[model samples]
Target: MTKLERSQIDFSTFMLYRLAEHWGKSVPDTYRILDKANAIDGYLVPCYDMLHTLGSEYLVNDLTDYVREQGICI
Candidate 1:
């Protein structure tokens, strides 16, 4: 990938980490949810589009709720 794409992936991963920490979840678990919700053709959605479409707060909240309801302790 290009440097810009790599940077965006890093930033997106960091955001996922923050979201996981905020919800007391493992990063992998959080990633699974994000992947399911936003992945396209085995890749994550672009960071800008993801943030614009779902917003960080809403995405975290929705994933938190879903994880809690599913009782996914990991």
Candidate 2:
């Protein structure tokens, strides 16, 4: 993969763990919820440039909002 692609993946993984921790869920569970909502591919990856610059709490909140906006329960 290109360097940029790798960077995005890394950032996405970081956010996944952060969100999982914030939600008191396991990493795998967090990943499943995110995948079910299409947040990883449809939102996170596409918005990586802008998102990677945001703070951790803000990014987690943004992701929480995005997932909820998609009508996901968790």
Candidate 3:
């Protein structure tokens, strides 16, 4: 894959695992939650340019808020 593509994947992976840990859920479960809320594609990936610059805690919190706002209990 191209470097940019790889970077995006890496960042996504990092956020996935980080979120999983933050939410006390498995990676797959966390992924499901985000996916169900459309946070993964709709927000996370699309906002990666700005999201990646934030801290891990902020990212997790932001994601949590995003998911919650989507009306999914995560």
Candidate 4:
């Protein structure tokens, strides 16, 4: 991919990470939901898939840390 595409990938991954936190959805489940949406709307597929695949584990880890840090006591 070009530099811009790669950059966009990184940004989109971050977006998905935040989105997962916002919706209280896990990485794997977010993929299933976004994958379906992307299927119905092709334009979002690349970013969505990249986010779902590339950032999943990291997002989960980051989210765990965030929750722990916040001390929400969930």
Whose lDDT is greatest here? 2
- On TM-score, who's better, 2 or 4? 2
lDDT of 4 at 56: 57
lDDT score for candidate 1 against the true structure: 0.61
Off by over 4 Å in 2: none
TM-scores, all models, native as reference: 0.54, 0.97, 0.92, 0.50
Each candidate: what lDDT?
A: 0.61, 0.95, 0.88, 0.53
> Residue 56's C-alpha lDDT in candidate 2?
96
All candidates in order of TM-score, best leading: 2, 3, 1, 4
lDDT of 3 by residue, 5-60 (tens): 67778998999999999999999999999889988789877887888899999888
Local distance difference test, candidate 4: 0.53
For candidate 2, the per-residue lDDT at 26 reads: 99
lDDT score for residue 46 of model 1:
47
The residue-by-residue lDDT of candidate 1 on 13-69, one tens digit each, is 766887779867798887886666553223333444455355667766655565556
Error of 4 at 25 (Å): 1.0
Off by over 4 Å in 4: 39-74
Q: What would the per-residue lDDT of candidate 2 be over residues 1-74, giving only the tens digit for each residue? A: 99999999999999999999999999999999999889999999999999899999999999999899999998
